[model samples]
Target: MNKHSITLSFEINEPQLLLRDAIKHYGISKKALTSIKYEGGTILVNGEEKTVRHILTVGDKVTIIFPEEKSSEGLIAEKGDFPILFEDEHILIFSKEAGLSTIPSREHPHGTVANFVAGYFAESGLSSTVHIVTRLDKDTSGVICVAKHRHAHHLLSEMQKAGTISREYEAIVHGFIQQDSFVIDAPIGRKDGSIIERLISQEGKYAKTSVQVLNRFHLQGEELTHVRLQLHTGRTHQIRVHMMSIGHPLIGDDLYGGSQKFISRQALHARELNLKHPFSGETLKIISPFPKDMKDIIPTKTTK
Candidate 1:
């Protein structure tokens, strides 16, 4: 078992309130309380261990020690130079690099973003669970959020399902886009006879994407359009397939008939994220600049 502990301390606000009620009032879950009772956790009042049934007065200092989570199976924490944009008690925002999968899969289980985060948590002596709130494609680079514990994870997941978590992306497509701004409203489903590829079909789930052209220029005699995209509904390869439907696939995306002359992977980056914090209720807007490979693929006027 891991030796580190997660401790939370606060003063009681109501007089004559029981320890369990105070904990619940402070947003601690009933399941966590059960863990404290059965999993060697501790509860203290004014530096002395107390039961949840004990009563409390105003300004009484109460502390709860949460034990370490047992190490999960098949997760080998490996350290790396992770780019952290923001971190707090509840969550973390990381700028994920290209070529790294967000989580482990059957074929490639190690060197994933989750493994890197586990390593960071271990090195920091933290015992909290690794909870990824947002996942990006393996070749996609940009900001992703990770919850430090289960409560935060639950809140964020609820927000995502409610369509409150907003994400923006940037990409360089193969052809110039004529419209300044437009939306793609279509349904997406697994391509027939293919397990991975997705297509636009009537018998698919609803998907919407908003696109705005940022820059239109020529690179090496090939017309390229730099565009900003907002996803109304998350779908596998939504942007890529939508753009392909309009005859402008992402640069270097071989699956959608894009050229690989400029870059080896898809020219897509999750550039921005906006959401409300689970605990603080404060708005968070995180942004990440384009990676070198993408920047080089869409050169500015000065370089051209």
Candidate 2:
């Protein structure tokens, strides 16, 4: 057996049904079934090879061996330092530092989190491709989720679509917000003629962000507020755009009209993530502490 191949065995408990039906009842997807049939996978009943049409009965043992996975070309493995928050056979969660891209792009074709993960998989002898469940911006630091296999990826994607996965972020905005808590309901669309900029527009898709003031302080005579934000929609630059729309752009977010006199990049961090396990159905809460640069901005008791 390949070390990376996932094998699941189940003892049938229901009445007579086709093996395919049993597999579907167990949450196996149609695409996975097709892969099992066409790819180098195997299905067995009572320790003997069987097809999907085989009749399944109570007390029958069904075993499924998933196909081997291969990393895509150009995803060169490169080792780097990354903090692991949680890991299991089905999932891997890690804290990503600011200034590192989550995945490679044409401009940045290497040295990303994906490349490092590929290297980790190779060193660990896991024959799996990189499947990022939650992606953060290149300049955003926070916890990110990754699936270990195609099946896990599919299940987690479903969870994301169903709105079962949630995230919380902390940021320092330019101006102090008077309101303690509020929601920004706006539409976000790409700025005209810019592939990287997003703005509030009437023709854009709906985006909502819940904001709460965590603390208020003055830095070098400039008013600033620390806020917690939760996204109801995952639009590109949603938080940055929404904060700017409310007249409190994140500090150092120059693209969104924030000043960069104090910090080099946006003062945003993915603080927490809440989701149910794809396989175990248990709630998982992962947290990342404030990075040194973000923490330094907060004033001490005497300064506040």
| Candidate 2 local lDDT, residue 7 | 83
Off by over 4 Å in 2: 302-304
Models 1 onward score TM values of 0.81, 0.94
Best by lDDT: 2
RMSD (CA, Å), each prediction? 3.9, 1.8
**How well is each residue in 1-304 modelled by candidate 2, as lDDT tens digits?**
6777988888998877899899887778999888888989899999999998899889999999999988756788989889999999999999999999999989888989999999998888888889999999989999999999988999888888788899999999988799999999999998899999999999999898999998899989999999999987789989999999989999999999999988999999999999989778788999998899999998875222
Top-scoring candidate (TM-score):
2
Which parts of model 1 are misplaced by more than 4 Å?
A: 1-67, 302-304
Q: Model 1 clash pairs?
A: none
For model 2, what is the C-alpha lDDT against the true structure? 0.90
lDDT of 1 by residue, 1-304 (tens): 2356667788988899999888887667777788778987889999999998999999999988876565545787889777788898778898999899989989888999989998898887776668898888888889999988765776688788899999999999987788989999999989989987898899999999999999898888988999999988889889989999889999988998898899888899999999988667799899987799988866657221
Task: Give lDDT: candidate 2, residue 114.
Answer: 95
For model 1, the run of ten residues with the poorest summed lDDT: 295-304
Give the Cα error of residue 7 in candidate 2, in Å. Answer: 2.1
